[model samples]
Structures are given as structure tokens and as C-alpha cells.
Target: MAASPDTLARVEELTARRLNRTLLARQHLLARSTQTAHDLIHHLVAVQAQESNAPYISLWTRLEAFEKDDLTALLADRRAVRSSILRGTQHIATDDDYPWLRPTVQPVLDRGRQGAFGRVTAGVDPVELAALARKHLTGQTLTRPALARLLAERWPDVEPLALGWSAQCLLPVVHPPPSGTWGRFGATPFVLAEEWLGRPMAAPDAERLVVRYLAAFGPGSARDVQAWSGLTRLREVLERLPLRRYRTPAGVVLYDLPDAPLADEDAPAPVRLVPEFDNLLLAHADRTRVIADAHRRVVITGAVVRPTFLVDGFVRGMWSMTGAGIVLAPFEAITEAARDALTREAAELLRFAGTEGSVSFTAPGH
Candidate 1:
């Protein structure tokens, strides 16, 4: 049960460092988790997987002994799926989560479709388009381009790309395996979430969604939930819930599950090499808890958020793989101890990536 809002009047206050450690602890960055990839995905609710290798790298960084096959097997068995959810981005979520999660975040997808394709599809009836798309997508998978071409059969005057984009946003669809699998990339193929999972989507439950958010990325504000979910007007929802409250140093109200533990601000934080678009950096409205404002600019440019390395539980630099090995690019100078730790982690990452070479560092801002 949740506590009443009246009980939150004397809420605790949290520092940025405390928030950072809490985020790291919940994300399993402080220590690798022994849970299977499937279970980890469930705990996370969903992992940002816009890039093929992103989810693999994400699991590797947080799991005790994750293998590429661990996740591959989940997709192969249909225990998990890749779909556009939460902020209308590609995410790999457990099959159990996709049903309710998709419906919860459907508004984000709907708004995305409208903004991107509404003009081209101005004259098309969304209901008719969705029905036709369902007809084509029910029993089989079709690549976006192929699906667009098919949609064009009925609406020749409308832009094919718009029609396809609309289907993707308007319907609860998912991209099948080898699409989100590691080292594989190609045209995105789509299938109905219901047909693929053999279950219908559940109704949106904002209360459940908020509780899950607090579990994974909590001690956050209403704006944080809205930011992560791409939904608006969540303040009303937050107020009615029985949640423990805390305020940031600057007085921003943050919410968390009543029983969720807060990590000690002085707890030791391990160096981490997270993948591009990892939710850790994007899960909150104010990211300063995990990344500095100056560093955020360099790490996130326009649409791309570069894979970053963490030192003392905060973004210290960006990293990428080279044919030879992993390359680290620090935004500023790092301590000898931090460098040594990063080098050792990089070596382990190389082994996991099945690459051979030495870890190297580039001059700052490279």
C-alpha cells in the first residue's frame, strides 16, 4: 500500500550524489546482477535498443555472466520483443511487459505518428489504415518498405512512407529477431504485437507504470516520469498515489517507492562502460544526477547520445570500439586510478565483444 500525500509533508531531501548512487544501484551498475537477461529486462521494464548492439552491451555491463546468446534465445523463443515504447523509441522489453507497457505508452506513439505523418496522411482515415495494416501484418512479418508498398495498393495518392509510419505508430507492432540481435542490421521488419506474442495488449495502467518507473528510475520528479514516458499531465497521477517524497537540494520534489532503498552517497561506485542510448542517461528529466551539463552537450549531439563511461557514478567520457579494440575518449582528464579501472573494464568488454586488440585513449574532445 502507498502512504497518503499528507504523510509526505516531512519528506527527506537528497543530494545529487545520493541520487546518482541510487540510480546506479537500481540499474545494477554498482555491481553486476546474477539474474538472467530475461529477468533483467523485466526489472528494467525495457532497455533502449535503437542500435543493434546497444542491448547486448547494456546487458554485458550490468549482468554477472551475460552471453550474446542469452538475449538471442529470448527473442528466438518469443519470450521478449523489440518495439517502440516509452517516448516512441526502440526498446527491448519482455513479452509480459509489452502488452501493458505498449498500451501505457501508446500516446507517445500516437503523437509521434501525427507529428511525422499526419500531413501526408491528412485525407486517410486512421481507422481504415490501421485495419488494412492489420490485415497485411496479422499472420506474417513485412519490412517497413514492403509494408509501405502494400499500403500504397489502397492509397496510391498518399505517401507510402507516411502510410507505413502511420501503421507502425497506430498499431501495436514489434520488430522480430535478427532485427534487434547483435551484429545484425537490416531493414526493420514489423509484426503485430498480438499475433507475435499470441496475446492481446492490456489496457493502460498509469498507476502501475508510475510504480514501475519509481522502482527502476525513481527518487525522481513528475517531470522525470513524463520525460521518460513522453506523456503529459502525470502530476495528477503522482499526487493520488501513496508515495514517499523527497526533495532535491534545489527543491525539486522527487518520488520513490516507500520501501525502495536509497544508496549511501559515499558508497563506492565502479567504473562502467555503458552503451549508446542507455536509459541511465535518458531516464530522468534532469540528468545532472548522472551527467554534468557540460558533458551532456558533448555526449549528446542532436539525435545521437554517444556511449559513455562512468567514473564515481557520473559520466566522465565517451567510448567506442575499434577494429583493434576499445577506444576511450574522456571529456576531461581522469585520475590514474580511474584510467587503470577503465582499461581493465575495456579489456573485459573486448572479450565479451569477441574482438581482439588493446585499449587505447584519445585526447580529450576527440
Candidate 2:
């Protein structure tokens, strides 16, 4: 049956409320059958805390009282780890979970190395290169350059930069402190993930991961999952799952866990200031979930994605604060209610930044 547009709109509203709360809410309810956005953000906060400092900031803007060290303590306990996840980018995840997540993402690293790094390390012996890295990094932490130098001696034909990427991407490695150390100063140092985490990377299970994502960010199309994970052929996995499917107004079919709650279409939404690289903006194939296409230019310019604000679940504009104060440029004219909410949100951000920054607004035509 074609999903009703009304049902889709209801789902969007409810999901926006859930996502508007941010990562803290997203992670909390990921494991539960019927989860709220708050619960999901709570869980994301908990998992993000595995890295500690930044995750707290990541949650603070989204949540109510995310302290700086809330996440620090988590990392100190080995409950979480910072490693490459989907799309081969760094994410702080539970140590218990990283083993499984890391291997699942290895294909990205593998593909990148062959397509990009392969040109550089064309003649280099994979076994020998891995051995060189193991030898250099055993019991000692080496920054990307230090590791590069060690390998460069053996594989002079390889570009040092390419060598660094290949080392981290092609092999099972961990970027240890003072890379992620709180307020510490140093470059990224390479160590084996197994050595640092005390366990080997787990085998890949595309199906379970897909299900997990759908549970957290579901009522979404298979393309959304692929967009989030950079994984392809997920349609097969989605089809196998016991999921309830629907179609958006655009006729794109979507899937979600059967009992997952969809946000109320008319739910009152808060103005939210999302951090750079916040998954809310990046989680879907079609971002109509939280943003409009015309406003895309305001948030994304070429490869740079700016911090954005959501008013009534739609991205009204982009924002930035400088010495002058908070500057908001809207792609569309916002209402007085939106302006008031944005003003309040901006003030909160200023307080977080530890200063009283003024606010300014710029409309496109004016």
C-alpha cells in the first residue's frame, strides 16, 4: 500500500523532535524497541562519551547538561573508542561495539587504498609494509609522519602522505593520544587497534548494523542507510529485515522497525543549532526529513558544510559568530516566532562560548 502523505508528514514531525534533541537522544533509545528522540540522544551521548570531551560538547548543544568531562571519564574507562566508522571517518563508539563496527567499515578503507593509495604504493609489499609499521609502533606511539618516515625508508617509492593514509586505512590501527587527549597538544599517533583495545576487529555483519541504523534513524529509505554508512546494496539487507515500509510524498519508499515511533506531524519544535558534521544533516539520502533543497546552498557550499539552524524542522538558514557578534543569514524569510526562538538559541550559544555575543539577521533579498 502507498503510505499516506499525512502519515509521512507525521513521521517527519516526530523524527525531527527526536533528532532535534541531538546525539544524546539518538544513542539512548537505539537499543530499545520504542524509543523517543530524547532517549536516542541520551544513548548517542553515552556512546559518544566513550571519547569524552568533544562528545560532551557534541551533546551539550543538543542536550541540557552535558559536561566537558562527562565524555572524558568514559574514554578513561575504556568503555568507548575513537576510530573510523561508516565512510571511514572517525567516530567515538563503544569498545565492545568497535570490534564489529571497524571490520564492517574495512571495505571503505580497502577500496580507498586500492584506488587512491595503490597508485602510490604500487610496488610496495603489503606484508612487508605492515610488518614495518608493526615494528615501528610496537610499545611506542608514532605520529603519522614518524610512521611515514619509518616506512619511507623501506618503500621509498611511496609518497609519505599516501603511506600514512594506507597505513591507517589498509591496516587495523588506532590513533592514540595526544590526538584526542583533553586539551593536550600533539599529533595523531598510530597504534594497533587490537593492542590498544585488547581485542581484534570483529567480523562484518551488514544486516545487523543496517537494522541498528534503521532503529535509530528509521522510517527512512534504504538509500538513507547507504548515505549514512557509505555502504551499497543495502536494499537486500532491508528487504530481509522484518521492517514496515512506507513511501514519502516523493514516492521514495522507506523502512523502519515495525514498532518505532514516528514523530507527531504537528509537534512543536525548538530552534536548534547543530554542530559541524552533526549526523542530523548527513543521515539521509533525501534530507527533506529536516531541510529543504533550496536552503541546501546555505548550509553546504562545495565541500564545506556550515553549522545550521532548524526552525520548525526545516533549515531556515546558516549562522556564524565572530568578533562582531552572531550573524544569521536566512535562505528564506523566517517568521517572528522563528526569529524569537533563534534569538534565544543564539543567546544560549553565546553563553556557551563564554561571552555575550550580539545577534544579526540577513535575509536573502534584502
TM-score of every candidate: 0.97, 0.82
lDDT per residue as tens, model 1, 164-259: 889999999999988889999989999999999999999999999999999989888999999888999888898899988898867678888899
lDDT of each: 0.92, 0.66
TM-score of 2: 0.82
- Native-structure RMSD, model 2: 5.3
Off by over 4 Å in 1: 1-9
Please provide, for model 2 over 1-366, each residue's C-alpha lDDT reduced to its tens digit, 9 standing for 90 to 100. Answer: 445676665543334434433322342311122432234343442222223233444555655554445555555655665666666666667666677877887888777678877876889877777777887877777888888988888878778888877888766776664467455545576778788888877789998787778666666777898887877888888888888766654557778778766554555566777655666667787776677776765577774567677776667777877776788777778889888878887887776655566988987533
Among these predicted structures, which one has the highest lDDT?
1
Model 2 C-alpha lDDT versus the unseen true structure: 0.66
Candidate 2: regions farther than 4 A off: 1-57, 181-186, 323-325, 363-366
Query: What residue pairs clash in candidate 1, if any at all?
Result: none
